[model samples]
Target: MPVIVLEARDFSSPIFLVRTLEVISGCITFSLVASLEPPKDPSDLHPTFRIFCMFIWCFFFTLTLLIHILSIIQFHSLIPISWKNLTVTTAVLGALMGLSASVVFPWMVIDHQGSLQRPVAAAVASCITFLAYSSETCILRTQAQEQRGYMGSNPGLLKILQLWGGCNMIPLVLGVVQSQWSALGTPSGVLSWQLWVSAVLYSVCVLMSLVTLVVILGDFAGRCFLPFDRFLAGFSLIGVFLYMFATVICFTKILQLKEPGNRASAQMTELIIMETVVASITLLAYTVDLAFSIKLLCDRSHA
Candidate 1:
């Protein structure tokens, strides 16, 4: 007998697939980049990191686009089509911002062997971070709230995400200032100083991002308020946060070697160990998150 199809509130399985793609791609890119030899000095910083970020940006952007397309198709057939804060417009804005950070800025802000690509990239990335992150938190908040009382959930988790957004923002803005000042003043000592500051800013923001995840995930597991499914949502965020944290930690340690000629030294070896530890934590986080996202989607569909 042919099974009859029922109207579903969500197109769960595809969302799962898309998210998995993002995670897998992000993980592969991160692992490969982490394995590379750390370079010496700020000049060496520009091209490599920029290219790496750009690749990540493009890959995620594609996934984002595909998800949206699939979403439209699914909504047309199953659930009512709705746009929360994380709408198509929001995704576009986030994508553009990410692209600027990954592709535009490094080219603009950092000089490749003494030539500038374009300085606006860093500034644009900052602006994008503020907007993208703010919108994303808003969407998460709405989702959590909607799921409230259904399976039990806490709205405060969204607040934590928002706070993390603000925290991560601080360094990005500073990074821009540092990049800009160094670009214009063209001071000899200022170059290293500003570059280091920018790195520090990004590093701090990345750390806060991870901490934010830790808080939310803590709530998800123990706080009886979160619906069983939304807990799954928290998992991916935790993983992504940790992955970012680990990668940044490795980069930050390398940035500390400012005097030149000591990038791949014994200190770097220790840093690599640290990076490995962080990566392990992140991957674990990712695994937990994948479980949550999948479970949430499945539950929501069945419910």
Candidate 2:
């Protein structure tokens, strides 16, 4: 028979407080949104965005609950995954996803609805949940520094930002492409080329970043036969160039669309703007990651 003991430290910790807030706010956000009826207007913001927000909140809530149950039961060692890595990764991804939902839910749904009570409340809860997740992420990151995990280091932390930014860019780019496809009849000419380039850039970056994160979380970086540091450095450099090109093309397309005779709808314009902003931020993260990777490689070589 297995013995179960309650871990008092889990309940008393700062992380527990933050996670509690996360659960509360997550429940509130999804419940409020879910209570509302779907928009019938075809011109209104798509239901997909609403569904995405609800999913983010509900998924994080369930994850936090699982973590709490595991901790209470003193089952950390029974789980095969690295507990610290899992916790930190959850915090980081939760924060990023919460922030996206906070922004998107308010801007796309609440703002368009003209101050409906439930939607407004849901947006507020979403923002609160984002803050909670962000606080948890900071707490974990600070604690992680004293540990031996790769995610505690500067380059590893940058990898999280890169991963989050790539994730953010993918959806925004897809939204823009969807809008363009609807408006332009068929994918053709410069618009088609630009959309294709942006999609490929975002997809490749996301894939590489996700792979790197999985390797780190699995503690397989050292076991890999490849030169991991060099691989990171090389990919970071490539990401910088790819993001730069994609960002330029996106802005140029936006400018062309805004010319005297040509104009996109407000929603499409907003999606493009959001996509460009995410691309620019992702570019900066990659640039910084490249610098850190080089420094890390140099120090390792000297040691």
The digit string of per-residue lDDT tens for model 1 on 1-303 reads 333332364435443344444444444433433344344455333443455454544555464555556554544233232333233323333433453344333443244324222233333433444344344434444455443222113223322333333333343333433443444454346445644553554455356545434443333335546664465466456545645654565465446555565434442344244434434444454555456567668877999
Provide the clashing-pair count of each candidate structure: 12, 0
Per-residue lDDT of model 2, residues 82-134, tens digit only = 67877777788888889899888877777556449989888889889989988
Among residues 3 or more apart in sequence or in different chains, the pairs in candidate 2 whose N, CA or C atoms overlap within 3 Å are: none
TM-score for model 1? 0.32
CA lDDT of 52 in candidate 1? 41
Candidate 1 worst ten-residue window by lDDT? 148-157
Top of the candidates by TM-score? 2
Model 2, position 77, has a per-residue lDDT of 73
Per-candidate TM vs. native?
0.32, 0.90
Scored against the true structure, residue 254 in model 1 reaches a CA lDDT of 45
lDDT of each: 0.43, 0.80
